[model samples]
Target chain A: MSFFYVDLSVNQSKTWEKLFFDLKGTKRYNKYCQDADFYNVFKQIILSLLLGEEIVLLDADFSEDEIKRLTANSIYETDDILVNKQLESIESKEDLFQHLRQINKEWQITLYTSGTTGLPKRISHSFQSITRFVKKSENHSSNVWGFAYNPTHMAGIQVFFQALLNGNPIVRLFGLSKEQIFESISEFAVTNISATPTFYRLLLPKFNQYPTVKRLTSGGEKFDEKTTNALKQIFPNAKITNVYASTEAGTLLASSGNNFFIKPEFKGLIKVIENELVIHKSLMGNSDIFSDEWYHTGDIVEIISQNPLNFHFISRKNEMINVGGYKVNPHEVEEAIREIDGVSDVRVFAKSNSVLGNIICSEVVINNDSLNESLIRNQLQTKLQEFKIPRLIKLADKISTTRTGKIKRN
Target chain B: MKKEKLLEIINTIKKNRNEVLINSIDETSDLRNDLGMESLDLAELTVRIEAEYDIDIFEDGIVNTIGEILNKLENKR
Candidate 1:
């Protein structure tokens, strides 16, 4: 278990530490990712866990020996070694203003996301923006929160960093599990839960079980009506909220409950041109992607409700798969796929096609092997638009994900 | 039986009907072809199905299994 030290009292010192064993002895838990090496990675993890080290800078382009060279420069109480992992990979050039900037009366969070390209895009958040979302739940209800996304992933990691930084407790199931989440809710008395629309679906079955939970928040990807309605019904006592933001942009747009009410406190300015969402660069506040005081949100939203706020998510621009002349947003088609039973994970992409110009393809990851390709395709026919359906569906042992819990889409 | 159940699940999800329609979905559908499901959605659905139906569809599965999933969900009812 990795632990970090936090000072609870000025006169005294405080440290938080815990040991975690893979509850699922699904032995493969230790089977490392192809992303990094075997030895140094574990070495770094052990040192960081045993010692109270918060940040470990990794240089992806650097050799392991080079990591050791940097480690020599690292001054920590623990013999923590640096691994060429996410901390290094999320690296982007820091703004020189970061040196000129003085932080006072506010907390700051540095955000790095896996954006449209596989590259990690970094953004900065003031205490007001990132933590403000978490604090918004103060007047809310919930018994437990499930924090399962990898911390290396910008969205999930923020949860990991903040849960401790804010003195909030959380539990992680081996993978995302409603059963495990329900168990944790009862076990830990958790009330507020945060997840991506994808992760929320994992725990969909457990909502009815938690009488104490009243707040459910989702981010990282699109949250559609089906998902919103499902969460509303499952946690009838809870409020379901969805936020639209990129790693480069943070906590930008939020919708509340089944009403999907947009929050009014957002200072960001938005414009929709040709069904695309655009933002004034100045609206980013302390964010990085808005260098010129304007940023284009590659998302589509409509002004659905005006009483309490401004807009609702309509669709996505990045999710668009160029299929010949027509641009197909993957999220638009993904909604149709979420209903099928026994299916675990799905991703849609466009492949060059001589006839259609580009044909859609999907990679499906499932635990059940009995259902074959035809059954799935037939099922798709019942729910999805024809062109949105995948031309081919390949079985994936596991869906490849960036450290940020987002599927790697090229 | 599988095809009928699969069709039912697809219909329920399409409506935004607050229900966990499929307790067990697998490779039988070209998930993209049959259900248009993505990898993250599939993973999340697997957990919800397991929790709602109280089924152990993950048994004998190292990653994700169609054979094992079918065997487990078949007797869930």
Candidate 2:
């Protein structure tokens, strides 16, 4: 009853109060019941809160069958694959609450950077650190960003907390096709939208059939020229923007509402240490848990803008793929391939090459349901810088996505 | 576009277009569901709207809401 559970079957969009009623009527959910209301997950979560258990809420897109399968088979038990020495799980709701509350006492949040580059990193966020992003919705667009990413991820978790405190309307848009997102938008009269380049890029071609959007926002992955232009083409003239937040460092930098931004000064001095930009937050990692203010943001961005801090994305310090003398950012090649029409999504990476030191290889997601290779190749030729072009492109029916919405990059 | 004309345009894009006309959306009916426009449909609808309204929306400064879009359409007339 305390949870606001949405009824997906109903034609009407339920207000939080209506959802609260649905929750009241619903029985306590075990992890397995298919069609179990997501709000039930909240109830289980709240129940876990009272009982001191750390419950991992998977994205609702997973069917009951899938949840049963994954929970039964997931490799969380093995610490071997845990990135950044973060394999250990904390026990109890009390453990999380204490850690979070103490952090909240002195700080506002602890966000984990998406592991798109290499490994996920933990970034400390004071209430002040996220002021822009916290009020991010109210200040920019009115549309609620449905938990587009996974709650297990930092962005999703932050959005969850932000929506809870702000009373914003955000449904979990798991497994729903682009069609469903459009439905949610019009149904909610949604005015603001946030998504990754892949999410929007995949949905862009379909824009030819949808209603006009009010605001469009994207981040996470490479928000390159072709993707931005494609978004513009789809939205016509929606308020489009991006941010450059990382996990190890929270909100270290943000782009202006326009694609370009002047990198803001850190509370502490920031510098490009050994070509890798190291930013010093007054505090970094987990909580007021650690007090080291000077932290290196292992991201390497070419300093194109600074006063208002505008920096062009160069490459991740560790993810740079060198081809002979040519330094290639995986994102750069992905962006190039993305520029190619019919290329729905791309994951470009380095492979051992005899000619080039590390040759570029791409896994491309296309609407092979209807493919026109010539048109795409032509488009890629025009938009992409020669070296940035992928040497090989493999068409995929579905790109392997992490449990989170992020495409698996490794 | 007149209600009937709008209905016709929408119908061509959707499977059951007459149902949309029968539904009769004004400011309240959500185009995505009440009218049956999916995400792809919305993208297509905007293209139609842009062609019909002869306006540039979905940019940095363009109006981005349904109500605002409707108001813009009304004003254009």
Candidate 3:
């Protein structure tokens, strides 16, 4: 079976045979820190998991400072533990599939949160928990995925496992331009696509309908009616599904439309406390941040019904700013602005607006006179999603701080 | 002169999004349809216009076209 498709100009598309050939020659690592292209990254994760090795997925675009913080200075270090897997003996594609099916239960995958509040936190998941929602049926074998998330993130991992377990081919669509994404969908005859609402928003003002796409899934962000209507127009044949998941919890609730209903099995595990959705510890990944039996998801939801417990996600708690209907983490925006060359410090907060509930505003302190509001906004456009970019940017001599020395939000 | 400044603000938001720029706009130009401005774009336009004219064009009601925005600014003056 085909493995994945990449840009032909950069590298040749790979197949299961190529993956097998590479697997035989590759040296295994107990704890791998992968920062590579989509193909190599996916290949490494598969190899590590099948061999029962721990792998830390790092974003390719993460700055060195971010990497140092996330890895705790162990960026280049690998464990010296002995791994006794005889992957080389596997000669055929069937053998490789057999090996993949029996994934090592001890294998752990670590992922970092977007660090919306502070430094990115480590969340480790067992192989079973990570693939909790994966469906492996004969009907799923022929589906092709339009991979559209950063491979390091939880959403990407979910899509990867779903496609991998079904032995389905995936087309690389993350970080690609709108035109490139459209081209890949048609060229690959992609049947299933799962991405954040932001990713689908980039394809807005629809021009063409992709008949080949049969299933469309949106998660990681709020799905609005305008976008849903636009997607319906663009992919007439596709059945749209919305998923509610988090770094703390894997895929849990899904709906064919806006409101999500908790499955009967998950009724006791998931609940809403004071409008905030909470998940029982059994459904979550291991993290130090979770201290209580019920992990407070920080996601506020509006209950639509009580009998079946159907609800719609409203907004995030505390520091999250609701801009229009999109949730923007102030700290995430602050982090992006702080990456600008001349930016010394920045404080991102929300300002009330008549047009969109709230508009993001930032007060930036710069080290150089050459940096201005427009220049910084232009730079931020590259690093952040459009909704996260501050609409009103004010250059300041210094950011006002509280007595605790934290940047003041008010 | 006010309309010119407003057009510049609209173009700035358009440029950031990599959308087609409009050379000229009249009172009949619909912000959402003709100018292709979304809610976020409208928010940016409000902030930029507020910065220039010290008025919230969308404070009283939702303005659909360039004419409505001009009327708001004219009333504020």
Which candidate number has the best lDDT?
Answer: 3
lDDT tens per residue, model 1, A364-390: 766567875667777887777666776
TM-score of chain A of each: 0.65, 0.67, 0.78
lDDT of each: 0.50, 0.52, 0.81
* Model 2: residues with Cα > 4 Å off, grouped in runs: A1-15, A18-132, A136-143, A208-212, A256-270, A287-293, A306-308, A324-326, A353-357, A367-389, B1-77
**How many clashes in candidate 3?**
0
Strongest candidate by TM-score:
3
Best by DockQ: 3
Q: Lowest summed-lDDT stretch of 10 residues in model 2 chain A?
A: A80-89
**Cα lDDT tens digits for candidate 2, A1-410:** 12232334344344555543443444433322122354554444433333323344454555556545555554234232112311123343234334433332332333334445443343444444544356534453333545565554455555555554444566655456777766765555454556666677666665553234556656665577766777677666476767665554444444534334533445235665565666565434454324555565666766654554455666667678776567877876676666655677878776554334565656887755565433444466677655555544567766666655565645
> CA RMSD for every model?
15.5, 20.5, 13.1
For candidate 3, write residues B1-77 as lDDT tens digits: 87898889998888767688889999999999998898899998998888888898888788999999998889887
Better of 1 and 2 by TM-score: 2
Structure candidate 3, residue pairs in collision? none
**Which is the better candidate, 1 or 2, if ranked by DockQ?**
1
List the DockQ of the predictions in order.
Answer: 0.02, 0.01, 0.41
- Supply the global lDDT for candidate 1: 0.50
Sort order, lDDT high to low = 3, 2, 1
